[model samples]
Target: MSAFDVRDLLKAAGHPGQLKAADAVHYAPTTSAIPPAEVGAPRDHGGAVSPVVLAGSVRIADLVLVVILGFAIHHIQLADMVGLGWRYPAAILSVAVLAVALFQAFGSYRIAAFRSFLKPALRLTAAWSLTFLVVATVMVFAKVADHYSRIWLATFYGLGLAMLLLERFALLHFVTARMRRGQFDRRTAIVGGGPLAEELIRALEAESESGIRIVGVFDDRGDTRSSSVVAGYPKLGTVSDLVDYARSTRLDLVVFTLPIAAEDRLLQMLAKLWVLPIDIRLSAKATKLKLRPRAYSYLGSVPVLDVFDKPMADWDIVTKAIFDRVVGAAMLIVLAPVMLGLAIAVRVTSPGPILFRQKRHGFNNETIEVYKFRSMYADQSDFTASKQVTRGDPRVTPLGRFIRRTSLDELPQLFNVLKGELSLVGPRPHAVHAKTNTTLYDQVVDGYFARHKVKPGITGWAQVNGWRGETDTDEKIQRRVDHDLYYIENWSILFDVQIMLATPLSLVTTKNAY
Candidate 1:
């Protein structure tokens, strides 16, 4: 009955839920037929289903996948120089997965984000570098790091970059071709049915990316004042009819081409249409202040400031993913000897299984089993820690104390990297019940849910900077959360590299690494 969460409304309705019985919902194949919003922007009389947008997206994904996967195989073959007769496939697969991740993180597939290669290219380099550094640093710290060769790492990077460049070039050519034929168009409409809407529609019609197809305008004003044709787009219907047309068609954006100075009327319109799933944007040309320089992004050289961006919208995510897999797999192959040793030690020292696994909150608040060495006495390993580990804790085994301190106990979780529950670098995931000062971590931090916006890490920004181990105090966890938030907000490949480098120094000083 509800419109659902603003973020999930469109996405959820597409799912197989019997959400609103038969007449309550309307469906159309956007890939084939997109209804018009502006009178001037009509569907092709030629009856051709435009394939450019879909084709471009799919081709970009495929090309990146192949190149990234292929280069990873090459890297593994090089790592085979370390005599890994069996671990090679896993290592390569890890790289393949991370490469995909990096691509996703970087938003390589997003339409607006990828229009310029300059920013995205630099980001790709940063994301891949950080991923490699994180995996390699962890392996070296564990003391059995000689399983990989530098030559293969070099080869993989070189080949991967070459493929990336080639793929982007090919994509550019293809996208341009589609634009030429008007096959990849973002059909948009204005709601105000005013002079501003007409101007905004005209402004968008003049740009590339196949330019926007401006559908007819919508206004409730009587015909005498609000004419039939507004900015060359006919007044299709009233606001109610606009909603109906919206149900029957595919519209990428709905511009509220009204000035903020007209506060009362704008508020009324927003209340009426805010429930819809499409991007609701305000045309910002009339604003007095030049918002933050960075806040304004050009829509064909006309500056429109950002409001709600699609989360992990583009290339930034794509690149981060690439880093995760490539480095995650490398760690698994290089640290196998250490992990195998830890497994044996755990079995020898305790009655239960070798690995310690527990439910920890992961990306998007999903409950995930995080793997570690069974450090506590078998019958007493706390699924939710009743007490924090301290110096000379009796619940810890003799072996557990040493492995936990050296962090060798965490080696088996390199597979968690392979499993995709954890990233090579992120805010380390905490148990669902993890708390400080008798309060859950989430309750104490105002933006705690924001952390779940990203994948949790095995070793994170806080951990590497001496915030590891038990959270015995409120301030301790807050500081850690502060650092974690800092990492998330100001994330870059270089920052990740710095964290990886600092981890060793920080670990050796594990004064609090209970």
Candidate 2:
């Protein structure tokens, strides 16, 4: 037996006996561990699972939190009251606060852990029970047990646990059902097809609860480096093919499990793939040092390096959708009277339907029939989105220019938000054939497709910031895309509010509008 440094191995593993002292595959610890560029390369360390997932899991766990905290506090109160007979009320509020904090710290309400509470959950409950017991014991030792109410104390402890567990059970059922329907699933795709990709597939397959369904893998290389089968998932196509596939596929995540050492090739791949509207992550399993420890995340015992994270994953999308509908509905209700007047004006001015419908690009470049109040001569209306309406244009009726300038023509789009085809605020969508000069916007701009990352809106950051109106020049459309991209990069509810507030003021400026 070679007397190796077992302690060092244990320390590296962060625990004793996790691994035996062995020579194993030791290497020089002094090289830059960047991700590989090419396909079919063997990636080293499994990349860390996202910590954002953990934070999200903690928030979701709050579904069962209120009950859990209530129970623990009640139990403590009941015990204090039973001991003190009338003083339990004084201890109730303090105990409740402490229980909630302890629950949060102990990861008692983590969505992953809460999904099953019997084995780990049983341990969690027991641990908390002991914690509360110590607090009760300390109180007794301090001679403060006689003032609490006996019945109130007993009821709180017994009822709190029951409610917490019951609520958790209900929440688990709701979450699991939504997940099964792909309603709560993270749309996942794999990049590369070799040993590393195989490991990722196996790891994901093993964790059924992780809710990752591999859409497919994209590899640039042929069979020599890239396998037709990594684990069991088939190679969907090449890296360039992935660009097209992403546009068409409902992919939520793209995991590039490429080796970090292949820097040149990776940059090339990033150039082609980074333009899409999905979460991109580089897998760090094959790196030499497994990173500086902070880079890797622990998913059970497996440590992984995180490359890129997709924005608005899982519940964030749900929350945003909720916010959209609530705000959209309220706005429509508030603006109903104004919309009614606009409808009447459109009908009286143009002897046609009050609404004008035109096909336009929406979320993911999908064509949606966008509605607007008619603002031009019904017969001469540019429904095909071909002509730019210039100032002093003959195409516009007398009523048309006023509504167009005031943006009263946009009133019908509120119904689009009502129909779930649009959001209240987002990048204003353009017509499918919308182009600057002779070239289309998508072909001209390198990452123009990324603007479709989220849903389109009636009023956008671009419009509110005076990037709206006719795209008469290359510079015009380019500035609009830039502002749209900026809006996407820093979107929030407050950001939307600011843009909405600025829209009316922006309409008054009228720099580009015809």
Candidate 3:
């Protein structure tokens, strides 16, 4: 934790003088606690699942069903009436796209709609019908109806509707089963235990379909001021304990029920809570400050100001996973011969294993074993990287010097990316004891652990921007952290592609690595 003032931020929000000089804020980043064996490990806690994932899966499933069934009906039932040409195939794809858009417009893909079949079934039917109507209109206007069969269109509509209904019913059953196992619930916690907390809890419970399960409440006050329990939920611990609990549990959203006017307390709380990779929101339901409708978002009708949103959520996660797996596999296959040659050269030249594994802090502070080709003498290898490798170090082997300088030793980590322990582009992970000037990296930089919010990568914005190499000075690490934070804040698939493409040019131009 590092102490600083957030007065500037508060002033920008039109609220100032909310804190005394003594109440300095601390931005926290802690050390990793897990071991090397759990590399790319899944979180131990289980139960709650992301609603966005469920909704996205259902939407994709709808598209596949409609496209597959449309082709099936055309081939098996309408081959005689409809000619085999691009017109019918084009129509099926257009209907699938249109149906999906209409369903989204009707709110049929919402999380609430997934938990039941009747509402989604009705919405699906209407959307499907409208899709056919719109497509027919377009065909008629384009004078392309003569090439299509009326019988094919009618049969496709009826079959698509029945198939969609059946899929919805199956999804309803699956959701019900998962809910019974507590998988659909969002494990939420309130960060205040006074009257505001009680009111917020009551309001949340009123919406039974929201799937938010309030695990407990946390407050800094003693039992004398804040009761042991509020609105049937216990005060688990103080605000500090909440941080530890969230790291170890499957906690989803943390809502602050303290008054919006309590700016000092809110700032102090956010300083500590912002490091965790979870959603942090400030309750605005009972606040007197009025803002435009766009400033506030709703969670079951209760307005909240989003303080921090968990990154790489929902479709972002899906997109990154697909990119990493597909691209990583292709790279591995393309580089197989080079990797094999390096492996054999290392074995013959040095008396050690070809690959070296070292534990580094991964996403959410989990310790993961990152792989690299052996680039040092077996007897002098640094497992923990406690001492920074300097220029002209004696531990480097003849072949090691070439590989280390060119970053060819890092090629083995393509395996880590494929295994899900690393991303193709993100903040680079550091050794557990990596430091600058005899001080740990986290101790030197405030909120340093924030970089672990996403998976560490084989290449990153910092490396491509000329920040790769030994961190013998404080300034080097600080610059790296600054660039890493920038990448996280402004991340996209295209941004990642840009970084990866520039990586080779960076390797050739930079000379700091030893």
Candidate 4:
């Protein structure tokens, strides 16, 4: 039968679609019991799942629910006691604030707490009860306990606990349903398909509750030494193939099973793998060497040595996003007049659109349209930027020359920041086909794609530190990459603010503005 006919017959027969030869070779379709590699015994990696998907939303919901419950109960029971004055509502707000603080302190909002319902439910209950006790004690100490009705206070405590418990139960149900569909689990892959990999897979499977779903294994060797299937999992491809696969997939973690003693092999693997934006860990269970307690992190009791971490992960990403939007919006407001004047100048000076939209590499090597005021004549503009703009270029208009020199042409990128395509501060996005000295960027630098681990920004450490503007030479691009890598390795809100403050000064210098 033809392939299409066979596929249709299989679908009609209620079987899954046939796997292609490539898919069959890479994926293990059958689930068979496999022996774990010889290693340490499994221990409790207790707590909620690591990398909760909706942590920020959950926290916000928790706070909102608490406030609603506090006000609802207060209105029902204590409205008449305070005579509709601001004092009672102010007191309720104080209680809500205390509840949120105690919830955070008790680790109620942690990833581990959200993995299971009972733990977080208990935690929420404790936090709420403690908040009530603390607030009641303060009220009594202040000699205002009589001002508040005892019935109202008692009702508030009981109702608050009930409401929090209900919220936790609902959240637990929602997360459980998502987990069953393999939604929240981290998409992980095992590096080095051998005995160590088999052991790691077995351990991860044993603690399936930990939210690590290993897709397959990857090994450089293809001979009988590196079998097509290790344990029950198939060897997807070589490490190089893993890089391409990672680019196409939403891969979260890569657990390397190579021994720590094999420094050369480990380094070789890392050099190729580091280009992708994923967490890379060394399997500690495979080695006999021991390190301090703090040196190890657990993947469900399977200890792994940290090598390279995906920069600005989880809450850091959330905080940076908030900072970008708040700051980006404020800057757009402050620079609107200047941007408007520039837009009018560009439109009148050049017979083209006021804004120049060019495709650039965004976070995780994805393509995004970046905005800037058109700085060159319509007919002469290099959309791909394959040819670098040089000093005294005839294509640059009178207005374009002025704006480009003063960095005013980049003001429209504040909207890109607000649109969430770029950040206020990060490694600047390069044109989709950007080249340095007639060579592609990745060909020039070893781990060039690593700079894309974070969102592209309007201003960056490289820009602020004199690495901005024309990347005419290979050394210039290399130095820019080095500065970007440095920024990624050591990033904080304070560091971003510092770079932002230094940006205007850098712009005024105009060292390489062409």
Candidate 5:
């Protein structure tokens, strides 16, 4: 079926971030587990320039420059500003905000605008001039113009505009260098080969500023059904091979060119590909099915249906990283004395190191060392955690039990948060070999690896909702995974704050923590 039908099927998947089987097809979730050996050593793709991040950063920089220039010009023009109470700072802040709003309304923050020097200079000048005119008119009508000097206002206008243009010129060179190195382009890949794939690739290439770089093509069929090369791009591998390729490399968009009539093939490919944390699109250029204009999103001029979107998009990732480092650092400073006392307690009571390090799966299933206050005895500690800790386990020291139940042992992971290996709120990272009964966590639940789509956290929605502690049964682990997936789908800055606030309350019931 084409996207017209598959779109409806995907709608039934409940959450937009999840994938489910269509009513007509029974998905068994029987695809071979991702070989454990390939979990680490992710291949580097050099550097990737996300347009959203670049655009947002540029916008923020413009605002800062405008505000600074306003203040600098005022101070230079009117050194005796003792009479002005809050008017100067408030006026400059308002002008700065309105100036940025005007720039955004005029489309001055686009990636293409930054690629050239002249276009941005002209646009910024126009927006800045208009911002001054509006503010001056407002001040006059409010009868507040008598409080400000005309000479100061004029100086700010000229100097601020000049400063903004100079910033744009510098940015132009930076963007140009990045473009020459191909860092500004999205690393895209095609999922099918033949006439449809050729048409899609050519259409994308036709747009000179599409910012899409076709890496290669991937198909499961033999050479007889699919060509070895299409539109000057070689076939990289089969569908399974594409999964491994994406996991290792920095792959952005994955466009499927298989015909809409091939429902079974599409279903199977979606089953395998949905687990990946990448954007998946179905090419609608060659499909006979037609949907409303809003139903299809375009890549360049080529229409496609967005099947999946990567969670924690560009700006969200930036915000989360900033929040983690800033808050994590502050927490460390505030709790230093408590942590020191706990360290001393552990060292004195146990015949082991104060800190225990274990390998845990981090973002994208990469192995990272997670730190904790040593809880088990020196010789009895299980670094791999092949054996689960149970209630009243002899390995736990007296001090260790108190720290574990109070969750003071997890304070050391705040360093991991600062190191960018963990978030303050996300799926809790599990030991690489953590399991329930005889089955690995991944085996116990389908799409379990999806939790690693974001960096694991010190605490999460599952923990705050009473899903923390030991998982001895499949049901317990399954519920934890379900809560984790829900958190991933509905994550926001406010949601994270809520989870963090509820964490201490959750620690009261540590019945399951050994």
Candidate 6:
């Protein structure tokens, strides 16, 4: 037996095993370990899921269409009756709202509903019929039933239901086609390979309609214990390797198949995995240990224990994108003169490009070109930013000093925000090669990459709280990372506004600003 075999034995006995590459092959009772093959290639599915045409957006569109249809029907029927007052239009609006609300109450807009045509169609029929009944009752109670045309109301109801059903059918077709093309599926990875992993894989594969495409399996155990193939899925790599893979790919979820009773093993895995900006769930079906009902969350009908959630997900991401564009555009327009004046000053005062584009770690550790007004002499500019700029740095120009102090240099990044490369408020993007105390920022902080789970921003909690400017020491970067993680965890639109509102005051004080 090898060192890895001994390690695995120790790990099974509840000791935290060292995660490393091992060549030994060991067998479990039901599933035997196979020799490791080459890591599986990433599956290619054409195009990402369309952000604009999601189920929620489609539901809202359905509501708007219903209101529009109602208005059209009312206009056609009541055209002959002059000065009928706002009663008819108001009734139409109320009925439309109530219809959409009923649809929501009946869960007509759920993903499962979109997966099949008949389910949503039936729900839509029921919801619309209920809405019409409620509206009729309200009209009767108000003694206004006689004021509206009965034939017109009946015709509108039939037309509205027909239109909604047609819409639902169209959406169903679209979603079905997208799923077949692998565009609408969630990319998932199993965190361990064993009997439990095989069982989970079987369960997931059995429900192909669930839209979870398991990318592959990842295990820290060597071939001795963990199989190279678990239920036909290739073991991708170790948990550390999984982190890098997830960071590079569009992995939506990481499912842990390790037993919940194995607290030490689970915690060790989570310590490495939580840095990722993906949903982490412990597969409850793999273990017999059951928790309270509230402790469990479901993915379809499968119960799993929620661990860490990807920050700024789904609607929150959409909301933040819209907020960034609107506010970023407004800020650009409002600060146009200041930016214009600064641009001219930089051009005349120094011989360099007006805007400096430097590579920074973006949303997923991807290198993105972050824009800034040139604040250093062109000849002396450090594109890599390996050397930290200090107070009264000789490389800075006269104009650069003033602009850097006042943070006018960062004004050009509003365009980056407009371009969707940055957020209005998030963890500030660090230069790709930025370092502190002769070491990379990631080296100083344990879960440093976790901050990059969300998009980098122009001004963040760290910047507003005086974590900006030169990060010369390990403590400074650590503090900044701590604040960034805090912002990510507690992010809300109001919190962003609060940070943005306080930014100017923070800039004015300029404690660490060079």
TM-scores of the models, in the order given: 0.50, 0.77, 0.87, 0.81, 0.87, 0.87
How accurate locally, in lDDT, is each candidate?
A: 0.63, 0.64, 0.80, 0.76, 0.81, 0.79
The list of candidate 1 runs beyond 4 A from truth reads 1-295, 298-303, 307-313
Error of 6 at 375 (Å): 1.0
Candidate 5 segments exceeding 4 Å error: 1-47, 85-98, 130-148, 180-182
Clashing pairs in 4: 48-112
Off by over 4 Å in 2: 1-93, 124-145, 182-185, 203-209, 223-225, 297-307, 314-319
Residue 338 deviation, candidate 3, in Å?
Answer: 1.0
Model 1: what TM-score?
Answer: 0.50
- Scored by lDDT, model 6 comes in at 0.79
TM-score of 2: 0.77
Give the 10-residue window scoring lowest on summed lDDT in candidate 5: 21-30
Clashing pairs in 6: 25-224, 26-224
Q: Each model's RMSD to truth, in Å?
A: 17.6, 12.7, 5.2, 11.8, 5.5, 6.5
For 380-461, candidate 4 gives per-residue lDDT tens digits of 8899988988889998998988888888888999988988889999999999888886987766654577788788888999
Q: Per-residue lDDT for 236-338 in model 6, tens only? A: 7787677666654567789999987777777667656666677888899867976887778876667888777877667787889899999999999999999
TM-score of 4: 0.81
* Candidate 6 lDDT score at position 33: 26
lDDT of 3 by residue, 1-514 (tens): 1112232454555544433211221324222322233222225432356688888887888888888888888889777766668887898899988999999998888878888777778888898999999999999999988788888899999888888888888888888888887777777889987788888899889988777888888888877998978998777777766676666566678999888778777776775676667788888865877888898988878778887887667678778989998999999999999999999999999998899999998887778999999999999999989788888999989899899888999999999999899998999989988989698887666567777778899999999999998998878998898788778778899999999999999999888998
Candidate 3: worst-modelled 10 consecutive residues by lDDT: 20-29
How would you encode candidate 2's per-residue C-alpha lDDT over 14-125 as one tens digit per residue?
4322321011111222212111222222111012223355445544454345445544565665444445333443455455556656676777655565456566456546
Off by over 4 Å in 3: 1-49, 85-87, 126-148
> TM-score for model 5?
0.87
